[model samples]
Target: MSNGNNRQVIRAEIKYPILAIVVLAAIFAFTSFALGYDQGQLFSIVVGDRAYEENFLHELFHDTRHALGFPCH
Candidate 1:
């Protein structure tokens, strides 16, 4: 009877996932800051008093914004 299970979580497995999460979080934060509804004006363009698309970043990354659960119209 031998109970010698030498299974350990590899550093790469842990690190890579954490790294990816951190990178994604940073990107999401940046995008939110740059194009969120509250502050979208900084990265948006207005025309003729009223424009169809106010947020350029949202329009440019429409699909991604939706996928990331960011409101965009």
Candidate 2:
């Protein structure tokens, strides 16, 4: 019936906004961690302990981290 169709439409519309919010939140968390907290631990899974020594992400985001007051050094 018409009511069922409307309910389906409402559910569909709600799903998209919820999905968008979840996706955006995930992106924000990832960016925040990468720029503010990452210090090679993420890359270490592939590169081994050398990543910790090299600190690739930390070096890459060095200036931004300092600007954001993350205290890299």
Candidate 3:
């Protein structure tokens, strides 16, 4: 790969995964405590924003998934 292509891939492999972890951690933590242990409520709150929530959900579900042994979009 050319230098620019290599750099782009490297950056994507690092940045999106990290962002996914942070977001997932925040999601878990908030669902665990900040929302009084109510997962459904938390889900509701998160989904309440409708458009914003759906977009976030898309980013979460598709682009930046869990930070595990997998690739994120």
Query: Quick one: best TM-score, which candidate?
Result: 2
Candidate 2 to truth, TM: 0.72
List candidate 2 stretches off by more than 4 Å: 1-16
Q: Show where candidate 1 strays beyond 4 Å.
A: 1-28, 35-40, 44-54
Please give the distance, in angstroms, between residue 25's alpha carbon in candidate 3 and its true position after superposition.
0.1
Spell out the clash pairs found in candidate 2.
Answer: none
Q: Sorted by lDDT, highest first, which candidate order results?
A: 2, 1, 3
Q: What is the overall TM-score of model 1 with all chains considered together?
A: 0.35
Q: 24-69 in candidate 1: lDDT tens per residue?
A: 9998987676655433455335443234346555566667667877
Q: Write the per-residue lDDT of candidate 2 for residues 1-73, one digit (tens) a residue.
A: 4656555334444345788889999999999998999988899999999999999899899999888899777
Looking at candidate 3, what is the lDDT of residue 6? 50
Whose lDDT is greatest here? Answer: 2
* CA lDDT, every model vs. true structure: 0.61, 0.87, 0.48
Which is better, 1 or 3, measured by TM-score?
1
lDDT of 3 by residue, 1-73 (tens): 4666555334444446788899999989864442232223335654564644444433544422343323433
**How many Å off is the CA of 4 in candidate 1?**
11
> What lDDT score goes with residue 31 in model 3?
49
Which pairs clash in model 1?
none
Q: What ordering of candidates by TM-score runs from best to worst?
A: 2, 1, 3
Q: Each model's RMSD to truth, in Å?
A: 6.4, 8.4, 14.4
